[model samples]
Structures are given as structure tokens and as C-alpha cells.
Target chain A: MAVLEVRGLEVRYPRASAPALRGIDLSLDRERLVVVGANGSGKTTLVRTVLGLVRPSAGWVRFDGRDVRTISGETGVSTNLAEVYRLISLPVRDLVEIVARLKGGDPAELEARLREFELGEVLGRRLFELSTGEQKIVGDLFAVSFGPRLVLLDEPFDNVDFSRRRRFVRLIRELRADLLLNTHELELIAQLDGWRLALMFEGRFLGPFAAADLDRLYLTRGTRADALAVMETSLGTFSVTRDSGDRPVKSATSLNALVESLA
Target chain B: MNLWRPYTKAMLANGSLWFWAFAFMAFWLAVGAFVESSGVGPGRSAVVAYTTSWYAVIVLLSLSMLAVAIANSLTYGSSALAYAFRFSRLTPEGYFGSIVGGSAVMGAALSFVLLGATAGMFGGRFRLLLLPADPAGLLAVSLLGGVFFMALAVTMILLVINYLGLKSTNFTGFLPLVLSITLGNAQIYLALPSWFVYGSPFNDLASLLYQGYAGTPATVELGAASVALTWEYLVVGILVWTAVLGASSLVLLRQIRSRQLEEGRQI
Candidate 1:
């Protein structure tokens, strides 16, 4: 069975005229799924919906075969404490201890996991004191700890240094579970193997393309500037540029295009 | 050791818990000193002690106010409660345990501290009882009465917290706690104010404490059923409040958990 499945999910903010996500359908068993879109293209919203942080105005979220609602039954952490659990910036120790208790992990095993993350010493410190890279490590560690068959990572690389980003890419390789991550960091795409890419525009999730297709998607823009412009307007924007040798480089035309492609 | 590990960890992990415990102890110490110093002499000390006990009453009243605010905040997501949700993994039961346990431990610690201070002030031969304080006798009655009041106070706070929701944070969760404290304090002077007393546990506690404090001789005049001062009363009262707060917190936690799940799924 697919470890995680989402179908026709839609999210609308309280007063917004437009929906955040209109009809997002996706599935994964154990492979890594990277969502690339522009800002506000619904990447984060999609992840949030899957994580059960946002309620869907429409559609269903399923982990394994169970509905997301059933996973959070009568006996569990309430919404009040949910925000606390989402605090990735907390010290590695505190986060692991909390996740250990939440997932009902054996204390010894939790300790082992902490050591594995090279965070045994760091755990004793406050979460806010950790470096940005350390904080991301803690976040990834927690997401991987509970054997969550399907994990949603929203903008996992935001504010992370390139070196740490590479480290996180290595960590992602070591992760033995399925992942659905949202980010615009293309560097990650170059490093991680066996991951599918989902392009997003406005509120739509475009192709779940292969790496070669993504390379072509990057290349074809130069050959078809008019098509790129049309796609950019619908998708948001497109820009053409050149290298030191004056080679035509077709890229994002505006911030909107960049955010949409990243989202 | 592992069994006590959670308690020790709790005490150490959250300095505020220890702070509340010690703060209560200091409060009781002050009350004891005030009572001893105000003595007009000999047998009439009872009257003086009675009046001076009002200091302790104020402390208890403040605690009630705090309880009310805490309950409301817990139910409503007031400041401290909101912080608790953010920093602590406290399930409803955990939250309740922390508050009630901290309160009682502080209350009892303060009681003893006050007693010691009072003895020191008198400078006479003070009878130090090595035996456990009577939990089932007169002291039990007093403590039980206290617990009844505390429970009612806690419930009132919880109800407000639950109903107030996000608005509970406006006053940093102090509003509900203060409101409870004020209302509970007002009850002391109102001679069983019609609204709070008829069906409330505090009514029973008020009569119980009066009887317990007054002793065996006054017991008959105070009521039909007489219970002696025993150590069990303190133990039992502590246990009862612990249980009550715990149960209520659990219920609240479940509600919060479900809401978060809906949120996560929405994510």
C-alpha cells in the first residue's frame, strides 16, 4: 500500500478570495517526493494539509490506509500542544525527548537516536541556542524518529547554508522512509537520487516529472521563449539571460516566477 | 529511582514548579510568624491566631485567584497556558498534575515552614511532632475542606478557559485566574453567597474547616457528623485534588490534540 496518499485536497484561508490549494492529488510509498513551486504556489499548504496542521476545505488525506482524522483519535496531543511539537528550533535533546514520549519510543532507543544525530550534548541546551544547521538536523531527526511512513517537510532548506544543505541532503539519503518536501532549493535536486519533482503554478500541481524531464524543463524554455512567456504568465513570469560567453539563458522573469517555480 | 525520575525531572526541568512549591512554603512561614508575633498572650492566642490566619487566607485566596486564572487559561489558552502549550508537551493530565501537584506541595511546604517559623518566634518549648501530621483527623477535615474549595476553584477556572478560547490570552491568562481568585475570595465574606454555595463543594469545605480548626469540643456544636484530625486527611486531600485536576486536564488535552490533528491534516 502507498505509505501516504492525498487526493483532491483544497485549502482556503479565512478571508481570502482564492484557495491556497485547489486540487492536489499525490501518492508515495517510500520514495522521496520534492515539490517545487513559486511562493504561495500551495507547496507549504499542501505539506501543511498532509501533516494535519491545516484543515482541508475539500478532499482526503490518508497515511497508509487510515484517514488522517483517525490517526489523531480521542487519546493524544491536542491542537494546543501541536504548535509546541512543531518547534524545530528547540534544542535537539528537548525535541527528541518530546518526540520519544509522543511516539511512545523506548527511552534507550530515543537516546540512541539522539546520539546518531550527533546531538547528545546539544540536547541538554535550549533549542533556540542551536545553529540554523543544527536546528534543521533536529527537525529532520524528529521527522525520521517516529517511523512516520510518510513525512511532510515544508521548505526544509530555508535559511540553511550550502554546506549544511549538503549535509541535510546526505541525511535525507540515510532516511529509510518516504518524504514529501517543499522547497525551491534546486541544489538538493542535483544531490539526492530517486526523488520525483512536482512543479506547481498558482494553485495547481503540474507534472510529477523525472530528473531528466526536469533538466529538459529547464532547457526547453530557451528554445520556446514565447511558450515560456505564456507559461510564465499562467505560471507567473519568465526571463531570458546569458552566460559570460553570451549563451542565451532562459530563467524566471520576476520574483513571482521564482516563487511559483520554487513553490 | 526510575519511578521517581519523572517527578525529579519535572521538578528540575521546570523551575517554576519548584518556585511555586517554595513560594507557598514561604507564604505559610510568614503567616506563622505573623500569628506568633501578634499574640496578646496565653489562651487568648486562639483568637489572635484565628484573626492572623487571615494572612494565610489571603495567600489561599491569591492561590484561588491564580487557580481560576490558570483554569480559564487552560480552557481558554491564556498567556501562561499558551506558553505551556508551546514549550511543554503537557497533555491535559500532565498539565493538571503539574499545577495541582505544584500547588499542594507548595501549600504543605508553606504550612510546615510557617509552623517552624512560628515556633522560633515563640522561643518557648515547642512540641515538634515527628509523627506524620494527622491526615484523617481534624487536620484531614481542614485539608479536605481546602481541597473542596480548590477543586471548585479549579473547575471554575477550567470552564472559563474552555469557553474563552483564544480571547483568554488577552490578559496573559491572568484574567480567569484572577477572576476565580476574586470570586472565591468574595465567597469567604458572603457567608455562603447564594450563587456559589448551594451546590458547590466550597460550601461543605467552609463548614468542614471551621469544625476542624475549632477542635473536638466545638465539633458537636458545628455539625452532626464528627471526624477527628488525622494525617490521612492531608494525604487524601492532596491525592483527591491531584486526581481531579488530572482528570480535567486529560479531557482538555484530548480536545486540543484533535484540533491539532485537524490542523496538521490541513497542512
Candidate 2:
């Protein structure tokens, strides 16, 4: 089952001249999906909309075949006492504690998680006092603790250092939830394995292109092509007979080479 | 101690402003007390009334202004601070609770300092002086007066912000403190109305500072029960202000949460 499915989604900010997003449809199962676009191309808006942070003007979002609205989206590990720990103004340790309680994580397990992220020493510091990078790591840790069915991150690497960025790439790959990340760095995109790629342009989904197809499309051409060209060039040109629909041209260059060329 | 760290940071950051305000009031009160002590008849009486009243108004007014300044600064600076910290762990409720809770603590600390200075300048009497009408009435007046007046000011501020959405560049977070102080001061000067000295908290608090100059005890009388009741009322009023602000905090927190959710931003 698709972990996340956004269908014909549209979002318009109040008093804005145009919609921030115009009909966007995409889906992901347990696979990681990287959403890439230039600034103001609605990448962050799309992620936020999927997470139920921003309401969609039209269309629906579902997580694991359930509408997002009905999902009882409790973010922390343990939702009850979690609210209290969150209330107290503690530092990194406080965050770990909240994560532990909400997620029902073992204290030892949490401390290990904290150590893994290099935040073990800063556990005693307050949230307001940490540097931007440190804080983002903590935030990422918190999101990971939720064990969410679908995880959406907006600019997760903005404040992350290079070392941490590599760690985060590994973390994203390891996250049990289906992942949807909106980011601009193509380098990060190159690091992922088996993730779908969604290219957005002018508030529309340009491609839910398979990695292979996208590689072929980009290699043969400077950029990803429209649906028809993507199918023709990557799959091969084909002619349709009156009696039969379009057929693949099997004798053409290997489809693998087409993808490899694009890669 | 850790709980107080954020509050203390706020105090230290703006410590100079608070000190300046206290110094200004101290100077004004000292000047009045000196004039009265000099035994100039008309001057003494004039200083006794006007100076004492002004002292009450100025102290609360300065405190209120300072409180507003600090809160407004924090609110406007929060966005940059949020980005700087990368601490997205705090829910909107948590973030706002800390800020508001910190402000309240700051207010309480300042109020206590003012109270101590005023009491010390007098004979260490903490209770506000009521013009004895009936012992019971005097006590009732003090208690209800403190509560009614503070709650009124707090409620008004909340209403203004809720309706206005704190977006007005001019008002934002500062107006509540300003309006609370201004109205509070006005009510203090015009006491003994509304069947129970409407602004008596100011009058009572102010009278403490001026009490050192009050050589004559002025036949003040009130029954013991009324006096006790009045003290209870004042305590309760202060508590009510605390409670109302705390309760209303949840509502504001939720409002902010809803707003952020709409924008796809976490608190």
C-alpha cells in the first residue's frame, strides 16, 4: 500500500495573487522520494501540505490508505507525558527525555541515539541555547523517534554540517517510514538508493520519473523531458496500429543503456 | 535553577532599563520625602498628597513600561531566535509557555523588588492603608479592589490582542503592558469609587512608601475581621491575575499552533 498519496492537491495562500501549488499528484510506498525544485517552486509547501501542516485548497492526502485528517497524528513517541516534558524548558537531554517518553524508547536506547547523533554531551543544555546545526540534529532525532508511517521533511539539511549531512543521509535511508524530503542539493539526491524522484516546476509535477528513466532523459537531453519524450526515448519510439495500442521498440538500444546514459 | 535561566537571561539582558526605572522613582520619592521632612506647611501638605500619589503612579507606570518593552522585544525577535536555535522540538505551546512564563516571572520579581523598596523606605509595613469607613468594608475594598482592577486590565489586554491578532506594528506585544500600566495608574489616582476604592491597590501600595513621611497616624480604624478579609482578597486577586494569564496562555498557544500549522511551520 502507498504510505503517502497526494492527489490533485492545490494550496493558495490568503491574499496571494496565485496558488502556491496548482494540481499536484504523487505517491510513495516505503521507498524514499526526493522532491527537488528551485526556491519558491513550492517544494516546502508540498512537504508541509502532505504533513497536514498546510491545508490543501483542493484534493486529498492519505497515509497508509487512511486520510491524513483521520490518522490521529501524534508526533512524539509517547503522546501523553510527552506534552509535559515538552513544556519544561530543558536542553538536549530534555528533548531526549520527551522523545523517549513519547516514543516509549528505553532510556538506554535514547542515550545511545543521542550519542549516535553527537548530541550526548549537549543533553544538559537548553533548546534556546544550542547552535542551529545542533538543534536541527535534535529535531531530526525527534522525527525519527516518532516511527511515523510517513515522514516529510522541509530543508532538513539547511543548518546541518557536512559530516552531519552524511549521517543524515544514512538516517533517511534507515528511517522505517516512507520518506518525502524537499531539498535543493543535487549531491544529496545522488547519495540515496532506490528512492523515487519527483521534479516540480511552476506548481506542477513534471515527473515521478524512475531513477533510470530520469538518468536517461537527463543524459540524452540537458533536462528531464515531458511524459511522451520520457516514454519514447527511455522506453523507445513506437508506432501505434489501428488494431493495437503503442508497442515498445525492442530492437533499439538497451533500456538499461538509455537509463545509464541519463545517469 | 534551570527553570529560571531563561527568565534570568531576560532580566540580565535588560537589567539596565529596570535599574534606571527604579532609580528614577527612588529619586522622585526621595525628593518628596525630603520636602515633607523639612516641615514646610503648605509645601508639606502638597508634597504629602501629590508627591505620594505621583510616586505610586510612577513606580507602576515605569514597571509596566519596562515589562512591555521586554515582552515586545522577545515576541518580535522570536522568529530569528527560532531559526538560530534549530530547536524545533518545542511545540507552539511549549515555546509560548516559556516566553510568557518567563515574562510573568520577570514581572513578579520586579514587583517584589518594588514592594521591598517601598516597604523598606517606610516602616516595613506590607499592607496597603485603607481610609477606615467600616472595618469590614475597608478590608473588602482592599481585596476586591486589587483583584477587580488587575483582572480588568489583564482581560482588556487579552481582548485587544485577540481581536487585533498582534500584527499591528504599533501595538503588537507592548500595548498590553502599556495599557495595563496606564489604566492601572489612572485607577490608582482616582481611588474610593465603585463602592470599593476602585484603584486602591495603587493607593495602598503607594501609601506604604509615603507612610514614613506620615508622622501622624490619622486615626485609622478597621475591624480585625475586615482587615483579615481584605488581605485575603488582595492575595486572591493577585492569584487570579496569575491564573487568568496562565489559562489564557493555553488559548493563545493553540491559536499560534493553528496559525503555524496553516503555514506548514512547526512551532
Candidate 3:
């Protein structure tokens, strides 16, 4: 059975002409589902609504074969405490232990995961003192370590490094929990293998697309002015660049020729 | 997850907690010394000047004022309460504990600190710890009373922090403290309504201390705290205030819990 299920979900903000979520239907089982969208495309609303932070105007959300509302409030950190929790004066060991215990998960298991990420030396130091990259790693660990049955992450890899993103992807892949990850970056979506990709725009889900289409989406903006082009995705235009007709240069990297030759 | 760990380890770990307690301790100590050397205040006797129930009233009032600042010492209110909610996430009883239990634990611990400091002051200026001037029986009653009042102080802090927050433009939180302190200072000749005078826990405590002793001379003889009111009366009055403050705290806490779930769910 699917661990989380949403059927015909509709969320209407008071006096808003358009619903935040319009008759959305989605489900989650034991797999990673990547949701990509433009800014304010209702990605967060869907996650927040399913997490029970936003009351839906219609339809229902079910988690673990029961109503999501019946389960509990949100499990992961919200944006308000995100910075505070990171900069909070507590040491890493205590924080990991506290979060693990609060989520009803195994602290020892989380410790083991942290060690796998080679975070043992940093555990004794305070979280605020850690570098931004290190903090992102800690955040990712905290989110998935508890092995929650269903996890909703909004922009999980936003501030993380490109080099570290793959490793973080591996870590998420190892999690027992099903994932509903929302992001604006197609790069993050492309890094994952065997993950379902969904599109959203203008407060609606445009539906899922094949992972094979990842490359074309990155063409949203061209490396140069003449290369830019657009293609239709579900409900919105996917911008791309035509690699073949770009001044017929050997590569786009050599703007050097134009600079030295002058206009 | 020991639900109490977060409240104590992180929320109470700040040095400001000690700063307030020690500052007040110094202020009260200075008062004790000044009155002894200068022979001022209502009572000529040093014991009356320092260890009287009137002083207890002052300490309670100070703690109330201090609770305002203490409540803001990072990792409190919505954040702390929300974390505590995790402990009882699936249970109704756990929910109540996280929201209300923080102050209960803190108030109980601080009561002992307050008692020790108040009693320790009887040791003179330099010494304020481990000195027992009051006999065991009377000291116990006084300490119990202190605990109830301290709990009330903590509740006031939580309510103000939850309601006024730091963003409030008005003095909603400070209104009561300002009135109580101002009215209480003028209480000597104010001739306010009887209920109003006694209604203030400060007044009742002062009256208890100001009145002459009825207890065995053994407890009063040590000269830290002297009680005029009967033991039964003191206990009943304190318990009544405890009940009153306890109920008030729960009411305020219900508001905090709802705020956490609804408006304060900032992400």
C-alpha cells in the first residue's frame, strides 16, 4: 500500500482568485519522488498541506494508511527554527540525540549514519560554529535519520554544494522513508536515478515527466544570447538553447574570440 | 526523550538565570547591611529588617519582574514548547506535560535556590549559602510558600513571552508588575480595600512576616525567619495562591499551545 496518498486536493486561500493547490492527486510509497517547479508554483503549499500545516479547502491527505492530520504536526524543521536550530548553542552530539529521541528513532543509528558521513570529529563542537556546508550536511542528516514513514522536504538541497549533492542523494536513497522533495533546480532533480519527476506552475501540478527529459529542461537559459529557445512542458514553456545553431562555433566557451577581435 | 532535558539543558543553560538571581541577592544583601548600619526601615531589629516576611514579599515581587527578562532568554516560548510537544506527539498527556511541565520543573528548582539565598542572607553579607537561621519546621513552611510564588513568577514570564512577545508596542506584560510594585510600595498608608491589600500575595506574605510569632521559640530563635500566622493558616493561604496561580498558568498555557499549532507555525 502507498504510505501517503492525496486525492483531488484543493487549497483556496481566502480571497485568492486561484487555489494554491488545484485538484491535485498524488501518492507516495517506498520511493523518491522529485518535484520541480518555478517560484511560487505551489510546491511548498502541497508539502505544507500534506504535513498538516495548511488546512485544505477540499479533498484529503492520507499517510501510512491513515489521515495525515490524524498522524501529527510536521516532523522536519520549519524555516523559522532552521537558522536558530543551526546556530543554537548546543553541540552536535546533543542535538542529534535530541532530534533522534524526539522523532522516536534510534540515536545510535543516527550516530552511525553521521559517522558514515565522516562527521565524528565535528560532533563535539557546537552547531553554530560549523561552516555553512557542514551545517547543510547536519540538516540533511537530521531530516532523514529518524526513518519517518513519510518525509516531506522543501528545497532539501538548496544551499548545499554541488560536489556534496551526490553524496547527500546517496544518503537519501539509503533512507527507509518515502520522500516528497520539492526543488526549483533541475540540476538537483537530474542527479537522482530512478526517481519520479513532477512539474508545477501557477498553483497547479502540471503532472509528472520522464527522467530522460532532464537535459532539455536545463536549456531554460542559453549560455549565449543567440542560443536561447523555448519548448512546451506540461502547463508552462520550458526554455532551452539550440546547441546546433549557436553561431556555428566549435564551443560556447570561447567568448575570447569576440573579445580580442572587438565589435 | 526525557521531556525535561530540553527545557533544562538548553533553555536554562544561559548565564542570565544566575545573573538575575545573584543581582537580586546582592541588592537584598546591600539592603540588609545598609539597614543594619544605618538603622532605617520599619523595624529597628536586624532580624526584622532582613529576615522578616516583608523581605520575602520583596523577593517574590523581584522574581516576578525578573521572570519577564528570563522568559526571553533564547530557546523559550513557541520554540521550546513546540519541541516539548514532540515528547507527547501521539499522546494527550504528553502534550500537557511539554507545554506546562517546563515552568513546573524550573519553578521547583528555583524555589530551593530562592530559599537558600533568602536563608543564607541571615549569615550576614559575605555568606549566603548553606546557612540555616530558621528552624526546620518554620523554614519548611516558608520554603513551600516560596515555591508556590516562584511557580507563579514563572507562569507570568511564560504568559508575557507568549502573548506580548518582543514585538509588542504596548506594555501589556509590564502593566501588572508596574501596578503591583507601585501600589505595594505605598501600601503602608494607602488604606486600599482590604481585599486589594491582601489580594496581593506580597501583602499577605508581608503581614505574615510582620505579625509576631506564634510558633515554638526554637524555630524563631535561630533568627532567620519569624512567623506570626499559625502554621495552618500560612499553609492554606499559600496553597490557595498556588491553586490560583496554577490555574492561571494553565489558562495561559492553553493560549500558548494553540498559538504554537496555529499562528506561530512559521516556516
Enumerate the candidates' DockQ scores in order: 0.20, 0.10, 0.14
lDDT of 2 by residue, B30-107 (tens): 554454335433543443344344444554555555545544443333332222112223444444444444444454
The numbered model that scores best in lDDT is 3
| TM-score for chain A as predicted in candidate 3 | 0.68
Q: Which stretches of candidate 1 lie over 4 Å from their true place?
A: A73-95, A106-118, A218-255, A258-263, B1-8, B11-13, B17-165, B170-172, B175-190, B193-198, B201-251, B257-267
TM-score of each: 0.67, 0.60, 0.68
The regions of model 3 sitting more than 4 angstroms off are A7-23, A54-60, A65-89, A125-132, A212-263, B28-50, B65-166, B169-267
Candidate 3 docking quality: incorrect, acceptable, medium or high: incorrect
Q: Sorted by TM-score, highest first, which candidate order results?
A: 3, 1, 2
lDDT of 1 at A41: 77
Please provide, for model 2 over A63-116, each residue's C-alpha lDDT reduced to its tens digit, 9 standing for 90 to 100.
667775444324421111111223334466655654454344555665677699
Q: Among all windows of ten consecutive residues in candidate 1 chain B, which has the lowest summed lDDT?
A: B258-267
Best by DockQ: 1
Considering the two chains of model 2, state its CAPRI-style docking category.
incorrect
TM-score of chain B of 3: 0.58
Measured by TM-score, how close is model 2 to the native structure?
0.60
lDDT value, residue B48 of candidate 2: 39
Across A66-98, the per-residue lDDT of candidate 3 in tens digits comes to 675555444542221243243135688887676
In the range A143-209, model 1's lDDT, one tens digit per residue, is 5554444556777777666665666678667867677777765545656677887766667776576
Report lDDT per candidate.
Answer: 0.48, 0.49, 0.53
Ranking by lDDT: 3, 2, 1
